[model samples]
Target: MSDHPMALIYGGTPHRFPMLLVDSVEELSEGLGRALKQVSANEVLLERFGDAPPTLPSCLLVDALGQVAILLLRERDGGAASVWYLGGIEAMTFHTAIPAGSVLRMEARVLKRWRTTARIEVKAWIGAVPVADGFMVLSQRGSGSNE
Candidate 1:
């Protein structure tokens, strides 16, 4: 869809609309990546909150960070068509609620990598305000069962 370089990266993956949270990639390197997610007032997820000012859910914020981690993993794999799964999350903290019409700036960095599993640290911000931060463990499909 978009002509941005990350579009090609995202296009090669299995993520799609409604669930694909990462909107754009600002930077991507070997073990780190930065991305953005624009929260719209009409977001389908906002419907779940009823009349709560259309704030983005905390879970989705973590998901957006995971998407960035996946992008980093995808880039590290040289754009290979590999499926990655979120195995676990640790020390996650939600500093504040994110409201609609806010742009989330997310960053993810690989902390360690083993045979089929990698640990990543992720954080998100709204302008200068930190919204969330956590560690995520991801495992590649078929390499081993994460469960």
Candidate 2:
């Protein structure tokens, strides 16, 4: 493991939850990364309403992709000192819901990079079946809030 403090996910607060589902970093490179999410039925998403639908939400997939970017940032430099904001998400498609007890494998490839902005293609799967796929545009923050 690198010296970067693997905080898992960086965007959770006193009230936020689902968006922090990143389990770990499996593989990392300068501009690409593969991440994982080990799902347990005890997650907040499954327990949100005593049975809303036994599946992982698509929103969580975005979190996985975002974590890939964060990992790339960490792998590039020591770690991201400033926040990386997700500027845009496009071509997102959800084909299946990752249920509990499944291992979610996520991979992100750097499509383009220019100083302060980056484009990435993200895909996530459980076993042989793909669950989510999307393109995300990220911007490196200089000195501002992600509001």
Candidate 3:
């Protein structure tokens, strides 16, 4: 856990803010990763949803998990550049609705990896409270095979 700033992590990824869901990495290793996202009322998604009590969207949570998976893949590949795409999601369960102004912590672990595809399991928490978990399949883009 280097506590590397978001800028440094950004250098290792292709995401930019308003789209770069994870703010900072809390922990990162070859097969595991943990990151944070501070949900705010002024977030674009919340603004887009409009007029509702600011609830964090579940899709954003999944995207946060995907970002962690990308971080893990980058770490595993020693910062090799590859386009990673979300291939599929499985066994996803949402425990509770996440509200805006909450800090979301996400953790992901690589479950398996093949030639150009990796399977990861991820979970989200809000200050020690579990919110969601799921398994996702990610594939390196332009790998020459279609799902």
Pairs of residues clashing in candidate 2: none
Clash count, predicted structure 3: 0
lDDT of each: 0.83, 0.71, 0.83
lDDT of 1 by residue, 41-111 (tens): 89888635555788888888877888888888877876666778899999999998888899999999999
Ranking by TM-score: 1, 3, 2
Candidate 2 C-alpha error for residue 138, in Å: 0.4
What would the TM-scores of all predictions be? 0.88, 0.79, 0.87
* Model 3 TM-score, all chains together: 0.87
Residue ranges of candidate 3 with Cα displaced over 4 Å: 1-4, 47-52, 142-147
**Clashes within 3 Å, all models in order:** 0, 0, 0
Give me the displacement of residue 23 in model 2, in angstroms. Answer: 1.2
Please identify which of the two predictions, 1 or 3, would achieve the higher TM-score against the true structure. 1
Worst 10 residues of 1 by lDDT: 138-147
Q: Top TM-score: which candidate number? A: 1
Q: Candidate 1: misplaced stretches above 4 Å?
A: 1-3, 47-51, 142-147
State the lDDT of candidate 2 residue by residue for 1-147, as single tens digits. Answer: 334434434421111355566667777776778878888877777535475646677776677677777667545645535556789999999988778789999998888887777888999999989898989998876433422
Clashing pairs in 3: none
